[model samples]
Target: MPSPLRLHPDRLLPAEPGLRAIARELYAAVRELPILSPHGHVPAQLLVDDEPFRDPAALFVTPDHYVTRLLHADGVSLADLGVGRGPLTEPAARAVWRVLCERWPLFRGTPVRFWLDTELADIFGVTERPSAQNADALYDRVAERLAGADYRPRALFERFGIAFLATTDDPADDLAAHAALASDPTWTARVAPTFRPDRYLEPDRADWCKAVDHLGEVAGIETGDYAGYIAALEARRRYFVEHGAVSADHGHDDAVAEPLDARDAERIYRSAYAGQVTAAEALAFRRHMVVEMARMSCDDGLVMTLHPGSSRNHHAPSFHAYGPDTGSDIPRRTEYTTALRPLLERYGTHPGLHLVLFTLDETVWSRELAPLAGFYPSVYVGAPWWFLDAPDAITRFREAVTETAGFSRTSGFVDDTRAFCSIPARHDMARRLDAAYLARLVGEHRLDLDEALETAVDLVDGQPRRVFRL
Candidate 1:
């Protein structure tokens, strides 16, 4: 028989009796709050199409790099899991499920394990942990559920208790699906588009000029000159605002935001448009655009968010074979104090620009991010992201930043995920961890229980709304 699976009620609470009791009460109060996911990679079109998920492997293994990256480390090929291989037949998906079951021990202490355990036992009614023996049975159960109308995208979305969901979109996207959602009287829930203009901002990338041209065409503005390109971006942002977008997301390699003279900026833009810009010139141009994005944010009401310091697509071979966000990206050391001087000097105190900063580098919590948020009224520290969203890292994040910036100055939790099924489970884990943290503070006499409870509610709902200007 497969080992029985059970999620402890007080799993992530404090171990001590007094603190544990306090945490249980705190968790109970906010555990059922509606999730406000301000940033993630789940497409709005998923609900727009309202399609059933393909299969177990396609749903869990293929689209989720977090699962596949570890499985790949165990010598399983990406193709074996149906990644980049299109649809998976029952037999193919079952085989992949068996592989995951056999290698399930590889995820023993991972956040993936916690989420899957919650998903399996709570969401899918699975009574046992995944094992080689139970692979087929578990797959059958999940497949049965997926075939039902209750497990379809919209139904599952409502079941997850998500209050607001924001999806990332390119500058050239028409957002027809966004319009469809907004106009649908049946779906009165909040679904917002986020303007993501990464490709159009960086001049050194291989397809920068073509991306710029496409952005211009989408905005119906000419991009023959540098100023025209800026206008095109501005037009697209306005289009997003009209479509119900409240925030703009930027994920660059670094956070450098230096300004450049008009002549220098124009020269670099013209050279890049002609495919003649040098690497150094391209870097400078992108840095200027970083500040320009802030200036744009000040004029428009869109909240600006930046998450940098990931050395994306670290392996060229894997990138060429599969593509980006395949879990090939790794975090690097980041120093934000110097890198962000130019932008901060210009608009760090501006009331209109709400700058939310996220970092993959853990070392900057106290050294840079917290201190920066402490001083700048416009700045707010972002939630843990990617590699640092685990239990220990999150605990350390609170400890590291609270002294300088405090809880109110940080943006509420952002899932920042692509895996759709794991959304509620991930948010639940964060709530539990936060309760545990607050319980410790209460025990230490730093805060009253009433204060902790109020703050907890704010973190789960109010903070995201305020930080993102929702």
Candidate 2:
């Protein structure tokens, strides 16, 4: 028989009895707070359509790069996991589940294991730890539950206690699903779109010209020149705002946002338009556009979220076969101080602008990001993101940034996930860790218990609504 699974009540609390008690009190006070997912990758159509999940593997394994990448590390083929491909047959899906269950031991001590354990036990009544012996049975059990209304996407959204969910979308996207959701009187959940303009900013990509032209067509602007392209983007930002978008999201190679002279920018744009741009010119144009985007945010009132330093599609083979976000995007050492000086100097203190900075590079938490956010009224430090969203890293983030920027200047915890079910688990982890951190402060007399409780609540309820302007 598989070992019985049970989540410990004090699993993430501090070990000291006094501190643990304080954490328990703080956690209890805010554990049930509604989730405000200000930034994530979950497609809005999933909730708009409100379909029952197809199967356990599809719901939990296939869409989650976190699971597939680790499984790929242990010699499982991405093909076998149904990645980069269409839906799998029932037997094929079960085979993927078998692989995950057989290799479950490999995930020991990782946050993946923690998230999976919490999801299976808490959400699905999965009481037995997964193993090859129980793989088929567990799959069948989840499949059965998924067929029920309780497990449907919209129902699960409500059950998850999500008060607000934000999905990242291209600026050119029509957001038909978001529009449908907004119009449906039956749907009460608040789902918003975030405008992501990275592809339109990159001139080196083969599809850059095509995407720019398409953006012009969608926004009803002429894109034969630089001014028209900028107009097209500005128009789309307004369209997204009309349909309930509050932020503009950028994921670039770095954080640099220096503006170029009008002549230089137009020259680079003309070269790019003619498909004759050099690599250096492409970077310059992209960097210049980032500055322009900040100016647009200052005018439009959309919060500017800068998530930089991801070396996306690091493995050519996987990228070619499966496309991006298949788990090969690796983080690199990033320096933000000098890179962001141009943009910060220009509009970092603008009253209308809210710049939320995210990084895969943890080294900048105290050295650069905290100091920048500490002084700038408009800048906010985003939560520990991507590889750093794990338990220890979350703790490190708090300890590193709190002294300089404090709680108010920090963006509340964002899940940044495509896996819908993992939303609550990720946020719960953050809340638990925050409670523990605050409990330590209260125990050490750095902060009183009442203040800790208030901080905990604000971290969950107030901070996200304030920073993201939800």
Candidate 3:
């Protein structure tokens, strides 16, 4: 017989008797708080379509790089898992599901394991551990549930108790789905778009000129000239705000935000647009745009979020085959205090600026990030992100930064995920870990019990609202 799958009542709490009791109480106080995912990747169209998920494999494996990347490391091919190959037939989907089920041990002790377990047992009502023998049965059960109305995207969004969820979207997106949901009488929750201009900011990209042209076309500005190009970007950001975007998200190779003087900037822009920009000019232009993005945020009131230091798409072959976000994104050593100095020097004390800084580099959290947030009114240290969002890394993040920046300077947990169904499970894990962290403080006599409970609630509900201006 297969072992029953179950979630522990005191999962992620401390093992010590006293701390465990305190953590249990703290978790309860904030456990049911509405999830505030102020930054994420779930497509708005998913909810607007309100369609049933195609199948269990598509739901759990194909779209989630976090799942597929690991399985690939365990010697499974991306093609076999239905990645970047359009849709999968039922038999093909089940084959992928069986692949995962047989390799269940690969996920052991991972946050992916915890999240998938929660999703399987709590959301899908799966009662047995997934194994080769049970793969078909489990897939059938989940597929059957997904075929029901209650398992559709919008219904699951409501069931997840999401108070506010934001999707990262390009400037070119019209956000018609956002408007559709906002006008619907039956839908009450807020699902806002985030202004993401990654392609627009980096002019060295092969498609930069075309992207620039599209920006001009959309904004009704001329982009053959440099001034018109800047205006086009500003216009798009305003359009995003009009469509309910609260933040502008920036992810670049680095956080360097220096700007060139007007004449030099115009010179570089002309070169870039004419496909004549040198490598150094391209680097300078990209860095310059970071400052421009910050200045626009100050004027437009979009909270500026900088996610720097990712070496995105590390495997060139995989990227060429499957496209980006295929989970080869890696972290490099990032120097924030200096890299961000130019932007901060301009707007660090500007009351209108809200800059949330995220890093893939863990080393900078204590030495650089905390100090930066501690000094700058605009800078809030973003939560442990991407690779560092797991349990141990999160705990390390708290200890590293809390001493200097304190709790208020930290941006509350942002479950930056593309996997929609894992939203609640991710939020739950953060809540539990936070409770455990706070419970340790209470046990150590550093915090009163009541105070710890209040902090727990604020971490869940208040921090994201305040940091992201939700």
Candidate 4:
């Protein structure tokens, strides 16, 4: 007989029975609240098109590195899972499901396991654990359900109670899709974009020169010199602001921010354009650009977010074949106190700036990030990200930062996932973990239950919307 599959009601709660009960009650109150996804990787076109998802594999496996990466690690090839190839000859939905089910053990004890199980049990009414035998049946059931109007992207967005969602976009992007979504009077879904200028700003990027050229074209500015390139970037930022982007995202290997003299900056820009920049020159250019970005944010009124410290593309072979964001990225140690001093010195206390910082380096939570965000008027700590976006990590983050920075200094949770279906699950997990944490504090008499409940509601709804100005 197949093993019993059931979702525990008090999942992710404290081990203590009384605390667990309180957590469950708190979670129930916020569990059905509208999702406020201020930052994420979902494309704007999905909401704009409002199309039905093609199939289970296309919907779940292809775009989500979280699922595919785990499957690949368990001796399943990406090709077998219908990922990164032009198209699969056997792109049969059931075949892909079989491959995943046979290796279900790979996700054991993982957050991905929690999400997948939740999706299967709650969304599809599947009480049996996925396995080689049940794969086709599961596939047929999901496929049938997906064909319904309720499974369409826009309808599910409503069902999921997503109040507002923001998609990440490059500086050169036209954002015509966002415009299209905004103009659709029949659709009330609020979809917007966030500016991500990493490629154009980071000199070490492989296609830096090409990216610069694209930026120049989009901004209608010449890019033959450093001054012109800066002008182009500024112009595009304004364009992004016009298109309803209120936040700018920067992803880098480190958070080093330095201001350079015009001469030094020009020299570095020339080297970057010529594809002859040294590693030090690249770092200097990126650092200088960060300072410039902050200045732009100050002028444009766009909230700035720096997501640093990921050692991207650790698996060389997979990276070469699949490209970035394919689950090969790994976190590394990061320094912020000194690295951000120069930028902080210039804009750290700026009245007009809003800069949120994120890290995969948890070591800095209490020692670096919390203290920095506590002091700097412009800085707020982004939620734990990437590998640290798990239940234990979220608990540790709140515990580590609350003493020094307090709740107000930190930005609330961002799902930051490409998997649209898992958005609610991710947010639900964060809410439950936060409720559990708050209940412990209440039990210890550190905080009153009324205050805990009020704060819980704010975290689930108000904080992110207000912070990102949604």
Candidate 1 root-mean-square deviation in Å: 0.8
Better of 2 and 4 by lDDT: 2
Instruction: Give candidate 1's error at residue 214 in angstroms.
Output: 0.8
Q: Write the per-residue lDDT of candidate 4 for residues 1-470, one digit (tens) a residue.
A: 66656998889999998898788878888988888887999998888787888888877787788888888777777767777764444346567878888888888888888888888777777788888777787788888999999899888888889988889998899999989988889778678789998888778879889889988998899997999999998998888888888799999889998899999999999988988999989988888899999998988888999999888889898888877777778889999999999999998898778889999999999999999989997889999887898888899999999999988888898899999998988888899899999999988999888888898999878778767877
Tens digits of per-residue lDDT for model 3 on 260-361? Answer: 999999999999999999999999988999999989999999999999888889999999999888777888988888888989999999998999999999
User: In candidate 4, where is summed lDDT lowest over 10 consecutive residues?
Assistant: 85-94
Global Cα RMSD, each model = 0.8, 0.7, 0.8, 1.5
> What is the per-residue lDDT of model 2 for residues 1-470, given as tens digits with 9 covering 90 to 100?
68988999998899999999999999999999999999999999998788889889998999999999999998888889999778889999999899999999988887888899999999999999999999999999999999999999998899999999999998889999999999999999899999999999999999999999999999999999999999999999999999999999999999988899999999999999999999999999999999999999999999999999988899999999988888898999888889989998999889889999999999999999999999999899999998999999999999999999899999999999999999999999999999999999999899999999999999999999999899
By lDDT, the candidates rank as 2, 3, 1, 4
Q: Which lDDT tens digits does candidate 1 get at residues 12-119?
A: 889999999999999998999999999998999999999998888877888898999999888998778777777878899899989988999999999999988998
Give the runs in model 2 whose Cα sits over 4 Å from its true position.
none
Tell me each candidate's TM-score.
Answer: 0.99, 0.99, 0.99, 0.97
What is the alpha-carbon lDDT for the whole of candidate 1? 0.91
Off by over 4 Å in 1: none
Q: Where is the poorest 10-residue window by lDDT in model 1? A: 81-90
**lDDT of all predictions:** 0.91, 0.94, 0.93, 0.86
Q: List the residue pairs that clash in candidate 1.
A: none
